[model samples]
Target: MGALAVVAALAVAECSGGSTGASPSAPAPSPSTASATCPSSLAPANPPAPAGAAAGAAPQVKLVVPVDTSTSTVLKPDPAQQLQCGKVQVDTKSDVAFAAPKLANGQAKQLLMDIQVPQTPGPKPLVVYVPGGGFVQDDKQGNLPLRTYAADAGFVVASIQYRVQPDGATYADSIADVKSAIRYLRAHASDYQIDPGKVGVWGDSAGGYLVAMVGVTNGDKQYDLGENLDQSSDVQAVVDKFGASDLSKLESDYDAASQQAAAGLMTVVGKYVNGPASTQPASATPATVAAANPITHIKPTDPPFVIFHGSADTLISPSQTLMLQNALKAAGVQSTRYVVEGAGHGDLSFTGDTKSALQWTSANVAAPLLDFLNQSLKG
Candidate 1:
């Protein structure tokens, strides 16, 4: 954790932590602290033997590219930052780093989750938020807008911070952290007043890819990093905002693009796979890259999905979302796709049905988002 630059978790001081049980009166929302008691019953029903645990837990130095945080001050904001929406309070427990047992480089990384609970609640539904940054940039703090919006919608939101590629971790490592976050919540569900059975995940960009992975690979032991092995990491619903379902597919697009465009696109996806797009699909760096695709994990049992992508997205391409949608349909899984006309990657503000200058607003996306979540999470 030394020169590794591992960001520390935040401390929510103003708000109290831990969950509460059923009560006659309104249950006030409280900040949730890490639980010391990990019940044996909460471990994965069938844990996979630690694959790379015995290897060096060191950081993949080769993949550790330099990231300039100067302009991105938002990456390292006040961990103790708090927001309030009327009687409902939004508190963030930042920098909650968990150890990824699968990492060859035993570098400990942290995750950030913002929790917001409603006043009148029993076991409230939970939504895990994963932000997008091309898998190499951005932090959980960058998800403030989405977190607050979801929190206000009455869903207990946990905006998580997972290790990006620059940290020398692969898609597998990032997914381990994502599943770990879900297990962490379920393990402490009662304390956080969470309905463990009613949980969903929403991610944008790189985060969307991880969420898609999370959705498709519900019980895959390989990605299960032995954390909370007793509890399941399956999510009930998924909101994927222009996330790449398959890196191989995205890289394949680089083939037809001009030299300059391919170079620019590789700058984003290359880091995730730890190599360049010019040498991908057939020979991506991490041999597991193809298997990492959400499409590979698709099955009819998979949870419902709401996919959002800018129809004109040139970054990851709208085709990525379409591919997954087609797979889901063939697999017979319930799915919804929102093709924002004229909208590009991550831009949810397309008011006109056909076209217009891009405008940005939470409501623009939130309307459909909230509806989807309510229909899926609220039973």
Candidate 2:
């Protein structure tokens, strides 16, 4: 925890701290089908393990503490402090093709991303943003406000488009696309002004689940598919915002009424794993669902995590985040949890664009988030 710098007044933070058609028959090729070759200098001889893989349980860090009324002054941004809402000068390269995995029909489906590089110094830390769209759609630009804010703060942000259920993509395909994007960025770090050694991931909702998988499965060859095999996809830190962790237990965590409200989403989950999750027996959870759960892959060696979820989320229960936090804690992995009071699923207060909204986010969300990133990636 020495890596993280303390931030004051985090806003009453109660901190606890798919598929269609037939499933893909085999994992994608390691080197992938991209024509580009990674340079020997940049390519790792062997896949690098997660940052703390060999180290024992990370030292416990006190993330939140009781604050006095006077701490409210810290909420006001200093005159020289950069604004977290407005647009800043950033160079963007949109629709950059990173990977092309072969589809069911033997045709290659190209994966794309938008890179936002702050017109600042060189070799800045990179944060890959994966937006959530319920696995049915891909929206690389879904959270522009936060993406720009991070860029303006001197981080290279890449918002990526991955294969979704509509594209006949399964869990394996979507996971592979995300890892491929990480490897792609590292392979071309110089072009993007990225620090290949310091990479992190941030995602919300369904995208949150994907980033968690990426974090837990670090150095796991099974998920490292497509191009840039020479490069590693292991991340230093992870920020999961209300992503479902355990699919098998997802329904049981909800109340009767909440389950009814989330019926459509459950159907999508069934399609995602190509099976019925709710009907499965407790003793016999579906292999696909088990494989898709981030908690299933948690280990003491995994990277540090910061999780956020709204206390009033209905579609996905707050218990889902608790499940992940508890598992990570039990495994001795470094983790911090914050329950945003009165916020619901995908609340705009967490990612709003208005001036007032940004002010709230700067104090409540951005402060701790950037601080954690600084500790994990830059420390």
Candidate 3:
């Protein structure tokens, strides 16, 4: 099957029996089942004391994320409260239409967003999670662990879906969809009880690239498309893990052959640029390529970013992350880089000079990850 066919199949599989748009009430999915689907590492090490407390003496926040195995639904928000962050509900609304595809015969697909809301009501900070599949596969369902963690950490979490390559969508199209989602969330902040100004984005690999795009393109009118034009798509912070910095230049980067091959039969970069470089070289010329490069868009006013990339990753050179870090520094943007030694793409492990590479990241990485989000979004 072609790329579109494979993703279409996955989309069909994803939408099978899943609900969207509204919340699921009555008997919820069993905690055991919901808990089973979430990664154990996502559980909160320290639970928050209560909703109201001193800033200096605040209690550790506990997290609760109910997983929806069958359907995606939206819960009606209670207008009575301000910030709610306990006894959460999980609703995975499949095929919530976001926008039309850029390709012919490309149907406007639904955004399968798993929205986790706290029972308590308040204008909580928001965290949008994007998944990684080389920008060709995978949907909003790919990052339950991070979604659960962010939700538990007290942010309104939305794991959004975006169109991928060969589906008639380029990297620009994907970024536009992400922006639309952010706008959608901001537009309906009251309904979701979100702090519109305190939104953050997180993703891995291709998703990381999208998150970086969101961070770098803040206030740029080029990507504000489809709906919610009045609302800003700017994110306050970004968490990118092993994402490619420059897609157009990937062909010349080390491991270019293997990276292109791993991307797909048709080059993912080619699809992003609308065709193979030979037929449409100008379409992906250095200028156009730089146009899509996140490093090219970094400005002093851009939000802070916390980046993670495996030093030993063979698919994408670690230098991509390094270059991004350097660009952020040159622009005077606050950025952090976690060079995971011996880690590969999507490897959450962060062993620092002891034991094994995969063992201690939970302590060394997850804590800092949470701290960064808390400082950036909550601070």
Candidate 4:
């Protein structure tokens, strides 16, 4: 805010203001963003950041187009910005400035983020996190808890907020926002001083769907147009926790066991499911549903993945993870799948020892997530 840095929640505009949804859409495609709503001063160029920071918010001094814009920019920190997240101390390390490329017709929303670097850095690896909110809920502000954990673990994290379907915007637009954010990162890789090649992605629930979308649609190069850009939005690693993995598969079996786990499927029909939302277009046709799912795209070269789900999940089945894991393995991809025996859809707190961590989501998940990025993107 001081040097013009925009945060994920207060994803400020470039002119001067700031402020900021949705589920997975289609297999995977290049991003196409409309106009941004965040103020210019709030952008990395002339940030008019929020006055009082959220204790739970990530410490972001840099302006990352929030979600849809041009190449991403990293600002330099004043080393004096001290943020307190409950009992944790977060440093908005850098006020790296950036601007969101002007949009077309739609207003831009800020998917604010906070980045944390390692103690000794030639350049630390990056993890761009997408928070979950079943197409109609959750945001960067909601993911404060998990973000702090990632920073303390050492990777330079990017906690993002994708576009929401606030009545006017469609579901596909939300997923497109995810792909757009990645493209921005790829297009301006050097500016963030990140290993463009070694980037990793992570998310929960709806966020997981976004991560999976990128994993399967990694090779499409249509979104990038810059010269130094790799034309590849492929990530090094993926971490999906209790997400709606296979939408088509869910449609096939609306099982009683899966009823609670994958509840929203019912909301589109009758009762038995009551979430924050659900809808059948009063105007559009059935084609929209199939057009907005992420599982439709599954490829071999996408990226290695580490997915976790709660066995007790009711909003989305644990078996959903299996459907995806099998797909990746069938395509000759490597993946680590773990189920928290008795947990539910929103619980990812299962702990496992470091040695057997891959089987759990404890301290083990972070290091392996880091290792996966190193294996694929590290130079």
lDDT of all predictions, in order shown?
A: 0.58, 0.64, 0.60, 0.46
By lDDT, the best candidate is 2
Clash count, predicted structure 1: 20
Model 4 per-residue lDDT tens digits across residues 1-379 = 1111111222222112222322222122233322222121211121122323232422222211121111111122221222222232333332221212222233333333444443434555678777764444435544443455455444556666655333233444445556666666666656445666667888887788778877776765543322334345667788887666545444233334333322332333211011114343211333434434455577667678877765444445555667777777777787777655444444222111112212232333334444555565564
- Model 2 per-residue lDDT at 205: 79
Best by TM-score: 2
Best of the two (1, 2) by TM-score: 2
Tens-digit lDDT track of model 2 for 263-371: 4445556556663223333225467778888998999999999887755454456677777888898999998877665445552322221232223243455677777
TM-score of 3: 0.70
CA lDDT, candidate 2, residue 331 = 97
lDDT of 3 at 326: 80
Question: Ranking by lDDT, best first?
Answer: 2, 3, 1, 4
Q: Which portions of model 3 show Cα errors greater than 4 Å?
A: 1-102, 251-266, 275-284, 347-361
Name the lDDT value of residue 52 in candidate 1: 21
Worst 10 residues of 2 by lDDT: 3-12
TM-score of each: 0.68, 0.72, 0.70, 0.59
Per-residue C-alpha lDDT of model 3 across residues 37-84, encoded as one tens digit per residue? 234443222211111112122122111222121111112222222122
Number of clashing pairs, model 4?
50
